[model samples]
Target chain A: MTARPVLSAPPAIERHTISILVDNEPGVLARVIGLFSGRGYNIESLTVAEVDRDATLSRITIVTTGTPMIIEQIKAQLGRLVPVHRVHDLTMEGPFVERETALVKVAGTGEKRVEALRLADVFKARVVDATITSFVFEITGQGEELDRFIGLMAELGLVGVSRTGVVAMSRGPGGI
Target chain B: MSAATSETSLTGADIVLKALRDQGVEVIFGYPGGAVLPIYDALFQQNDIRHILVRHEQAALHAAEGYARSTGKVGVVLVTSGPGATNAVTGLADALMDSIPIVCLSGQVATHLIGNDAFQECDTTGITRPCTKHNYLVKDVNNLARTLHEAFYVAKNGRPGPVVIDIPKDVQFAEGTYRSPADSMPKSYRPQVKPDLNRVEEAIDLLAKAKRPIFYVGGGVINAGPVASQLLTQFVRMTGYPCTTTLMGLGAFPASDRQWLGMLGMHGTYEANLAMHGCDVMVCIGARFDDRVTGKVSEFSPNSVKIHVDIDPSSINKNVRVDVPIVGDAAHVLEDMIRIWKARGKQPDKAALAQWWEQIEFWRARDCLRYEKTSKVIKPQFALERLRAAISGRDDVFITTEVGQHQMWAAQFLPFDRPNHWMTSGGLGTMGYGLPAAIGAQVAHPDALCIDVAGEASILMNIQEMATALQYRLPVKVFILNNQYMGMVRQWQELLHGGRYSESYSEALPDFVKLADAFGGVGLRATEVGQVDDVINEMISIRRPVIVDMCVDPKENCFPMIPGGRAHNEMLLGPDEKVENATPEDGMVLV
Candidate 1:
């Protein structure tokens, strides 16, 4: 028998979550987006909101994936934006917490309805709204947990889903 | 009235003019439109700042860039809304890529009409966000003075680039309190200029032990001003190291120096590229490792330990990674490197360096720039040679070039002894950049000989600038090597694309002499090789705008070319070249 040779797999593409503090000014967001689009870098998820009202500062959370070299370049390029004050790569730094909220709608009339409700209960999802034949469940958890819940609901007469993109923070008392 | 008096209430227009005066702005290249009328009215009321009206908004910005690159100050431009601001985008991108400091004042629709799509309305700030280093939108007249002052500060500071201030039409007419420079210092944008001493020590240590060291310089050294160039020259001389410069960095180091390897890149000298590829330690001073400079990154100087010195931190490791990265001004870091070398009592290994010099001399002895001289048709290289000879003794000549085969030939033949004397579009490679840049240089130094070395195809891109030169009575010379084709494109097509000529030939070229006459300027053409020198002399003696057309050989291609995507040592030499010792296997030295 001929021996089969084993080949090493290519480097895995790791996901990175980064947080940025920037001056809350007009076109600042456009500038950040431009950096990503102009350089052909991918942004998997993004969430931004003003953090400090007095200081007029905003925090932006971005989730992206790339090779190690590409991730470093993205961080470097992001830090160079004029309005940006600081950038923290949470994935590389240390432990971090991430949360996402998803709304799932299921339509059924009999056993499927009971099965949907049972699955929601197991997944710790709350019924936000209901109709005679449909139920809208609001589930909040880590991205993987949400994905698992959505996959289970798909088998139990799942009709639609609306998800808020990933919003992450460091898992400590320190604030960005 | 001195600007110190706070009791006077100034209109926004007056405030803008006053602030420009306080910033030491003597000239502004601009054009007037409906939305910018108020600013133009203010400009008309003052004799302090002279506004030169350009034929197109793009020319205004390029002229401003030329002025800034030559004068080492912030070039200012003013244009109206919509198409006017849109027209300046190319020049803004060019300035950003080349690191030329420019302050562009773009007029906008009234604050209420911003997103309403009013006549001549556009989102100026949104459009310019990517092109400008920084930008601002002034909705209220109360902030106009402060914003304009800050615009200049941001534009001229560390790693200088173009900054735009979009002011609404209402803001221009409204009343505002004018602020001085001392009052509106930036709060968050302080650039780090000092170098870390430990890193400087590390760099010096590497240089001390380096057997084969080469200094790769770039435009940042020129942008750092004359002192930086002086420090670089001192450091190179003290160490007795050979140096090569990028196309934009041509004049930063004296090209006449024997240790100078010619400009390095796709069309650079064979010695410079080989030295860059084979050096044991490479010290890149103020130049980014552009893809053109470092062809095929995996094979680029694989054995060298690289040290990069730049003012901008992001530029470091953006392309090719380096061992020691010093984020500081070129002058500051070079000063520290010199100091550290002196303190260590270190000197380069002379015997080992002699071996390196022997290799470099072997490459240089190939006569990479040599070309055949024909009596019938004037070669472009010969035309530049005659031009160089004509301006040999004069120290006040400034040369600018549009992009193409002529640009490479000019880079090879021209000798610049000082910084700011050679200006061309390097990063963006924008054609039609030379004419307006020459006009700007001429405007800055009225008595100096400003020549725009152009190709037949490239010059036609901004041929309208001839009127601007004539109106200002600026004695700028447009020297065209009329080769009747986009020679660089044609050469590439011939080499890489199996000689499918397709759209590269410039059909129906204008009668350049008649065109010059129509613009009310002197026009001269040399059809034969013998008449080239006389035509250049007559064009120079006219003391007005003149275009000298030297009909050059159309078949000539720029030689010593490292074909795109090839290693530096994989160069294609020209015809009739006899480097008897070089073998095909030796050409793949780094591969």
Candidate 2:
């Protein structure tokens, strides 16, 4: 008898940024989101916007984390949705760019406000609004970079924050 | 002015009927209400499309499913809004799981009153989105004809499933320009029907060289139409490989063939399950590796190099990772594989195949289907065997089954020789599916014998359908194996839960014989072994709808079970039978 192959270990859980192109119609986004929530798939972040007015096409970017098998299931399931035209896993498809924009509001005195501005400057954030006691800094960067900027501002008397989810694009001439 | 030119200036309700006629929808199963009165009036004005009024909206969908499965046509359903649409949810889910092609048209409140929590209003499209293949909410009369055609196209194409189209009352009253299906075909929802020849060639190579090979077929073959089943029979016969079918795929391959290895799964035959576990090359055609078929997924078919062919791209690699995955219609792929295999002219290893057959024969000799005989009371298996004998030579017989021990026993004992003859809710395991489905099948085949193999508990779930059968003069038989309990549930509790019989027992059961009489149908009863055959004959001879209540042994349990979390080889043949490959450390996992 031949030696039996050993059972492989469970696949690693890693985040994947998937982009989907779908018909821009009512209930299309709900169908995409319902699939993730119904199947118990973890959705870390999501962003959607109409991409083409003539074609009535919309692009949706979803950040999800799971094992390799689960990731395959997510993409396949998304592809089966009638309105969805294409699904591309940016993480697996070579180089890609992902960016998120966050508005950081800080309410503090002299030192904390000055420190917040310094860190925002390092993170390439722009002060969109300013008052005597607070400033709303709009920062656009990769999620990790924004996390670092938000972390520094949290200790500097950060009051509120609003962040857009990740939106991704493949780093090539091709488009979805 | 004429039928051909009547397309222009037609009400939305008239457009619905015209689209159904264009799609060749001969009959629809539905229950009408206030919101659907306009459509019902249009239905009354038409003679081409017949509507069967079921007692409940759920039965309408199931009946439609039966009609679809039996005739290879899209089943049409029409029901009202709110409670009518909600009631059809279970049937929609059932059709989705079984891949039955169904187009359910549900009436909704006026478009203006949709979100106002108006009387008899519900979000039918939103509620059915996850279950249906696709759904549409038609607010405009102009889009009604196109949406109706699209609903039919989506329901029956590729991997077939149920679709819902919610039409508001206002839209039904508005005049619209009706378009033909040819002009209104869906542009964006095209599914790939042709498979890559490279993958087909790869699969042929594996089949040619395999020492121990088996064909695992599923319901997709039947859904692909009878031509697919014919090609499957031809391909499997040409290769001379052993074959086993899933519960939903009972009639795709002739069960009487020498190569047949009965049904394979939890309560499958010992030879079939063991062959699946031990085969070196496993070719899965049109069947997903569902959890019930693959116990403890990681250890399932561990040694087999698998080839899976399914039409749905999403279905591939969902449960079990396969070596060769071909996405295409079953018939299309099978035709290609046969051609490629014939051109290559490669054969399996003869000596190794002989040894494999010898091993299979050894396992088959165990006769795991044998149960202890009892003349005092009717055993469910024995009753099924008698029923099979009674209908052995009948060529126009179709069987539908509810979910329970009776369904498993029917699968084990009943042998189907042709495609579309066996209809059962396999994936969803719905209890009330059989009777309504039988009504639907009877509607399709007016003179054919349609019988529903049901249990005492399950028969009660859709007992109201008996009135539907009587009203339609369907003459469908309801064969009830009256165990006086939810037999499967009670058995599971007895074996797995330390004999703690919960609410599984049917405490206040109706007298089925009298109930049949109450429904203005013939009622037959068989309480002992001697009367079983006589009762079956009498029931079959009756020209009216009949219910045969065969009192069976209450404690009889379906056997040859690979228990939850157990491997294929680790089967429990019967209650007293020894557990194969029993390990003390092997935990009992709850399903």
Candidate 3:
């Protein structure tokens, strides 16, 4: 029996963004989640939307991290499931753009409030909802930027956060 | 309208009954409640559909599941909303886990009162969402026809599961254009189920790489038919691995094959469980790793790489972890695995494979099934053997079983050379399933001999179906293993549970022969070992519903009990591997 090589992370493991095309209908999302859940595999972030004009199909982008072995399993299993037209492991194929939009709110006063706004501006976060005592910042970009914004706000009185989850795609790609 | 069938204006109930008739649905097991009363009223006018009113809503559903399993038809059940639908939950969930096809129709409390939680208004659609293959909360009365068509479509298609259609009371009573749809829709309703080449290759790689690989088989094999038996045997031979089957997957692997491990879980083979837990790689085919199979889920196959192949998506990770999960039909996937395996020019090492085979054979012999066969008035094995001899291969005969010692004996002793050979309540172990299921089976295959091998106490559950069977002229032969006690319970009392005898005695059975005559069918009692053949022949000669109240030595228990959680090789056969009990000529004795 050939031993499976367990590759070590080069200093740090990276999360690759993935996008998939699947038939849009009832139970489609459940099927996708089921594939992840059945194998004890984890899905870091997920989002699905009915993207086809005729209402017959949808596009789902998921963000997850693992060693190359796990990622291959994920792609292969996803491709084998019914109604899944294609599975594109964007991480392995080429460069890919990953984005997430989150609504972050912080309640504080004085220097803490000032610190929150300062951090939001640096991250290009928009203030969608605001009051004298609180500010709800809408941030759009990579997951790391959102994480940093949330972390700083947590110390400066982060109240609540609503994330639109992750939506990813291959950068200049043939459709998969 | 579906991409296949044309749209019709007939009311949903009209369309449903007509669709069922078109599919050759002979009988329906159901309960009538406020919401579903309208459908029942319409059913009254339809002579083609004979509906059996069960005492409990759950029984209606279970009886339908039994019916489907015994006869291989899409079992039909109808009930009212709220409690009526909820009561059927256990049965539906059982069918879901076992992959039995059942179409559940529950009456909704009218659309206007839906979310308001009106009187007896339950969101059956939501309640059965997870358990059903697909469920519909019918909103458009216009689309009711299509919805009913699709409900059957999903339930019977791909991996066979329960499907519930929540028809509002108004819609059931409403009038519309209804036309019978063809049985051909399930073909396209599901995606092409043929296996993908790469996934099969990966599975083959896992098979080839592992030193100890085990194939876990379940009811999915039954779904694949004769091809499953041959295909799986080929796969087993190719991979040179041992196999374990679920209670429902009994006949998928040939009993005569040494590599075949007996049914796993609760009453599963100890060797199979050990192999499952110890194997480096496990290929689970046509099975969901049920809680029973993986008792302490955390401790189940902890170090093994697992692959799951099933048609249902919910089954993928609902329980055990999967390394490679393939969603497709069993036969198709097996075929693909075979083709791709051959394409790779791979061959299993015969010497090494045969060595693996020897270990399984050792376990099999250690846990061999044997009864103390002597001059017994009725031995469970003798009954099984005689029944096996009597049934003609040219004729299609179906057997249904009630759970307990008798059920286990049937599962183990019956020689089913093929798949879908025996139907019993494997998951729930319900006692009263046999008779009703037999009636339903008779309804499905009108020409077949529908037999329910039941224990005396267990037979009483749904015993009222005897009248229903007679009313329909269904030739259901009920063989009652009259041990004069709750045999399994009594055995536990005798062996493990401190001999409590807690309501295990039979103070309730009437003169069964008189009872049978009373019910308008032939009845006979077997008090002598030599009488078994004649009694069975007379029952067959009667060519109608008959009851054989067999008086077996209640103490002659089904031996070789493998205690729960014990290793397979460890067994509690009769003392010193001997049967020293009193002979059957000793006659009936009161404990």
Candidate with maximal DockQ: 2
In candidate 2, position B49 carries an lDDT of 95
Of 1 and 2, the candidate ahead on DockQ is 2
TM-score of chain B of 1: 0.96
Candidate 2, B265-331: lDDT as tens digits: 9999999999999999999999999988988777898999999999888788999999999999999
Fill in the DockQ of model 3.
0.08
Which 10-residue span in candidate 1 chain B carries the lowest summed lDDT? B579-588
Which residues of candidate 1, in runs, are more than 4 Å off? A1-12, B1-9, B576-591
Q: Across residues A37-89, which tens digit of lDDT does each residue of candidate 1 receive?
A: 99888899888889999999998988998877778888877876777888999
The interface root-mean-square deviations, each candidate in sequence, come to: 1.6, 1.1, 6.8
Write down the RMSD of all candidates, one decimal each: 3.9, 2.7, 8.0
Q: Of the pair 1 and 3, which is ahead by DockQ?
A: 1
* Clashing residue pairs in candidate 1 (N, C-alpha, C atoms within 3 angstroms): none
Query: Per-candidate TM vs. native?
Result: 0.95, 0.97, 0.74
Ranking by TM-score: 2, 1, 3
Task: Write one digit per residue (lDDT tens) for candidate 1, span B1-591.
Answer: 465664467877788888899899999999899889999999998799998888888889889988998899999999999999999999999999999999999999888889999999988888888888899999878888888888888898878999999988899989878778877776567677898889999999999899999999999999999999999999998998999999988988888887899999888999999999999899998899987688766678888999999888878888888999998899999999999999999899999899999999999998999999789799999999989999987889989999999999999998887899998998888999999999999999999999999998999989999999999999889999998999998887676556689999999999999999999898999999889889988988999899888899988999888766567877778844433322233233422
Model 2 misplacement above 4 A: A1-8, B1-7, B578-589
Off by over 4 Å in 3: A1-112, A129-134, A141-151, A154-176, B1-8, B17-28, B37-59, B173-192, B196-218, B226-246, B251-328, B333-367, B374-395, B482-541, B551-562, B570-591
